[model samples]
Target: MRIIAHRGASHAEPENTAAAFDAALVEGADGIELDLQLSRDGEVVVFHDATLARLGLRRARIRDHDWSDLAGLDVGRWFAGQATPHRMLRLTDVLAGWGGRTHLYLEIKHAEGRRGRDRHRELAERTAEAVRAAGLIDQVSILSFHEAALEAVHALVPTLALVRNVQRVGLLTRAAQQRAGLSALCVAVDRFGAAQRARLAALERPVYVYTCDTPAQFRRACDLDATAVISNGPAAARRWFAGQTSA
Candidate 1:
């Protein structure tokens, strides 16, 4: 199974910052997972929340402020430790920092209705453009909880793979991916079992699980036939994979 770093080895470093990404790479993660939002200046930035409040900034949303203001906020410090005084990083900066060294699974948080469909579409295009311009397009795939956002990206970059993030797993993810022709499905690790894995596998597609941290859970995921699993402790996954290789 592929081991993905949840928010860049977030258990060890700050989530979604350069330090976290570096930590993930050092921890032997196969890929890094990070969230994306649009800045007021139309730039794609890496962050998890709709607001900057969690990062200790006075602003509520990254979209509400221009890059000039957003740039000034210390996004790293709130996590404490090495992430102290973290800087809000541009998506471009992230791509530049870990472009060749790591594979990126980018989750777009900007949804339609809230941000409008057109704006979401534009965000998709802008993100794809940046990835292409950075020559890292092939190394990244897009994911989102918003169906429309994923659709927008699918329409723009049909060749690029998209993953569906379902909140309540039923047939929703399967249906969404079937309709959109998405490349992968990301479900909560606990929501799936062997039967579900077989069903998804029967369709000749891959399944991914999120935020599983322990070796036992990882082993369970493998038994469930997950194609990939995301975790904050990527080092644990690395050890598991090494064991498998040796076995």
Candidate 2:
């Protein structure tokens, strides 16, 4: 199974930063997953939250600030044992730095309090443009919890891969996935099991479980025959996978 770094080896480095992405590649992850949010100036920034509270900065909506304003924030200092400061990264920067080195699972984060379908469509368009500009469309797969976002992306880039990130496996989720022509299904680790795996397998789409950080969850992912396992501890997951292969 493929091992994808959730937020780019986030357990070792600041989530969604360049350092985390680079570290994931060094640790032998098959791919890196990162979140994307649009700034006030319409720049697609690589970040996880709509707010900066977790990074120890004054709580401010990411969409309310321009990329320039958000860029200077020190995001890494809050992590335990991390002395060096790390700035927020733009999607363009990440694409330039590690575009072709590994597959990208780019998730479009739904902006809180944002209404209407236009916003999601615009995000999909901008993200698609960035991927095309980097010439890494083939290596990038777009994922989102909002079906509208995936639909917009599919309409914009028919050939680009799309993954539906669902919290549960149900008829509604399955119908949406089928309608969107999604390339994969990313479900929460807790929601996945033998029956769910078999059902998804029958659909012929790869199942990628998310945010698995512990050894037992990694092993459970393997037992389910997941097509890929997304985890914060990419280094540990890589080590485990290597051991399994050699065993």
What's the lDDT for all of these models?
0.79, 0.82
Model 2 residue 106 CA deviation in Å: 0.4
Lowest lDDT 10-mer window, candidate 2? 171-180
For model 1, what is the alpha-carbon lDDT of residue 65? 77
Quote the lDDT for 212 in model 1: 88
RMSD vs true structure, all candidates: 2.3, 1.8
Off by over 4 Å in 2: 114-116, 171-176
Q: Write the per-residue lDDT of candidate 1 for residues 123-188, one digit (tens) a residue.
A: 778887788788776799888777777777667666677888765657654555555558877777
Summed backbone clashes in each candidate are: 3, 0
RMSD to native, candidate 1: 2.3
Question: How many residue pairs in model 2 have overlapping backbones?
Answer: 0
